[model samples]
Target: MRSPKDFFAPLALGAPEPLREVPFRPSRMIHFFDPSNERMRAKVPDIAPTVDVLLGNLEDAVSADSKDAARAGLIEVGKAWEPGHTQLWTRVNSLDSPWFLDDVWALCHEIGDKLDVIMVPKVEGPEDIHYVDRLLAQLEARVGLERPLLVHAILETARGVANVESICLASPRMQGLSLGPADLAADRRMKTTRVGGGHPGYLVRTDPVPDGDDDARTSFQQDLWHYTLARMVDACGTAGILPYYGPFGDIADPIGCEDQFRNAYLLGCVGAWSLHPSQIAIAKRVFSPEPAEVAWAQRVVTEMGDGTGAVMIDGKMQDDATVKQCRVVLQLARDLSAADPELAAAYGLETA
Candidate 1:
């Protein structure tokens, strides 16, 4: 194992030095699009400006026969694309897939400069991250990439969730972790077929109504992925990396999608996957701090001047801990506002 002093050192000769801290950006929506599809490829330029991160999907959705086309298309997109503030990311095939090596090889050599993060699917432990980290260093060295490409692991398999903490701390290149709900559910043998959102059957009933009719008892749907999401959040927080909620498959159910996204937002996820264009608005709305919430956080920070002493604000107690929480909200607003003028106005961050 490498010593603490060498942890941030380059893994390969001539490779760029590792980052000391994972930079925080406005990644409120990881909007996915298949690069192999001509129509989708056509829309990327238009879509890139609207989303915080545009991910070129070369796996799962792209059929085996189309994988080559998808990779080439992504390279083309990367070369032509101009991502002002939006990040360019891609979901390469799982490390075990036959196409993985070629995918990494070509992207690193051809478009390493444009690419931001590589989302590796089915990562089960720190070992997987170590392999990717070394490989990325070698490739970055070959291409003379000035900036190191970050890796984002998808928490898909049961094993991945089990080793989530280790995975987050595996490498300095670890940008974040995204909870892959559908694959994780399947791996965990969960009965629900839905990709995300609450399952009515996975909830608790109102004490069976005691002596009253059990049929009349109210049943409130609890979040199915709450425990896992919370655990992932804590792990990511401990590692100082970002956490994101994966895709919600039900595109038709906008309300349910919004609910799932909101739950993730409240539980510390910075963003979520947007499989459909319609989900973009939902993610943006849910992930961003509301105007009223920003106002409240601002009030708390203003009243708790220097963020040291205790004070009462609108009948609520404000302390050092609460001020830190308020700062988190305010900082997110400021980051989002930097890229979005309308959001700046909403959060009252607009300067004359």
Candidate 2:
């Protein structure tokens, strides 16, 4: 392990200095597209502007036969597309995969300058990040890239979840963690086959009507991934990086998708994965603070003045703690509004 004094130093001789802080941008939805799919490749330009992060996926969904093509396609995307406000990222093959070496070497040497973050899948521990960190620094130094690329880990396995804090603190390049529910479920041997949302079987039922009518009892489905997501959020907060919700597979069920995204948002996730085009709007809507919420936060900030002492707003307490909460809401609104004009107008940021 490196000494604490050298933590922020570049691992490679001439690599750009490690970033002191992981920059927070508008990452409401990490929209995934299969780079090998011709139709998907054609729509990238149009989709790039609408989403906060566009990820070229080369892992999991990409078949073995198409992995090379997907990598090449992502390189092409990096070359051709100007991200503007949108960040460019890629999900490379896992560390254990045969394609891992080629994927990392090629992308870093080819379009390392354009890539913002490399999403490493199935990262089980800090050792995985340490490997990627050194490799990225070497590649960045060799390519003479001015900016060091960041690393994002996918919490896929039970082991990954167990070592999450170490993974987030592994390197200065550590950007964030995204909960990979499907693979995690398989690894932990969970019964459900769903991706990232709540399960009906995992629920709470109201007590029987005093044994009068058991059939009249109401049951509410509980969030299957809540505990894990909350833990991930806390780990991320402690590390000062970002936390995100991974894919919700039920694309046909947009309402359910929104509900799941909102749960993550409220739990402190900055964003989620959007596997389908329809889910893009759902993510944007769910992650952004509502207009009414923004208005309420604005009122609280105004009422609190210097964010000291206590006041009462609408019969609710407004103290330092509550003002801090209001600031969190307003800060998110401000960041999002800077990129989105419609949101700025809706949040009254245009005037502010």
Candidate 3:
């Protein structure tokens, strides 16, 4: 095992020098659909066209009896799916579960070439990632796979959140980390019964009125996930991997879900999970930068010309740092445009 000094040395070098060049396809929103659900499974072909990432979920929501079926369904889907811009991913059972071994063994041997990422659940530390990494490498070597499959960890436990930075850097094959709020709340012993959104019970109480008016307002409720989200953003940013907001279980409250996702997006999360079909459009809309913001970024790039020095924009100072920010948006726009032509047009990009 590598020492702590080695574990942190790469981050100390900084952001891996911006990848030399960006990938052609945009990874805006990773839409999560349960392959075990007949309705969702039936919609996969139709859904794949609209989303940037199509993930077949096998953990959490799938019933125990249906685990085998989900595995079979995913294998069939992976085999039948032709290469496309939309990347294919699957969330496997957790390492502790009876099903996880089979999930990995079958997937690695059967559809390893077709799969892009294997989402590992409840990852608590670097050890968890190391296990998956070694296993995946072994599997790839056995199958004579040309490219290594990537791994994504779900940061849900308190220990997982605390160890996120190390986990992100545990392996070169680590792709990203996602917030799993439901399991996190349970793991942390949080009192709220709600999944991943603001709860009145979890809020601060208002002060009592001097005149004894019970209806008087006091302190307002703040986001419960503020610290976790910020910490996750910093960890992911530091490690050069992407961070994502997990699913908001209250599918009926699309507005609240959007607000939660927007908070994560503003805080530097690259994408979010969409549990229901209704949640997909909300995620796609929230995670992508607004056209006004994108247009302004484009203007800044155009104004800078050479992208080396500072200048004034709307009487405000713009510099190399600001231009770098603009490039972030431009890269995202270009990637999204490549992935979905309709979405590209909606964002005012010229679609082919």
TM-scores for every predicted model: 0.98, 0.98, 0.88
Q: What is the per-residue lDDT of model 2 for residues 255-328, given as tens digits with 9 covering 90 to 100?
A: 89999999999999999999999999999999999999999999999999999999988899889999999999
lDDT sort, best first: 2, 1, 3
Winner of 1 and 3 under lDDT: 1
Report how far residue 62 has shifted in candidate 3, in Å.
1.5
Model 3 lDDT per residue over 4-88, tens place: 4454233222222112212335556788877776777788789888777899888888899999989988888888887788889
Lowest summed lDDT across 10 adjacent residues in model 3 is found at 12-21
TM-score of 3: 0.88
lDDT of 2 at 56: 98
Whole-model Cα lDDT of every candidate shown, in order: 0.94, 0.94, 0.82
For candidate 1, list the clashing residue pairs, or say none.
none
Q: Where is model 2 more than 4 Å wrong at Cα?
A: 209-211
Question: What overall lDDT, based on C-alpha atoms, would model 2 receive against the true structure?
Answer: 0.94
Against the hidden true structure, what lDDT does model 1 obtain? 0.94
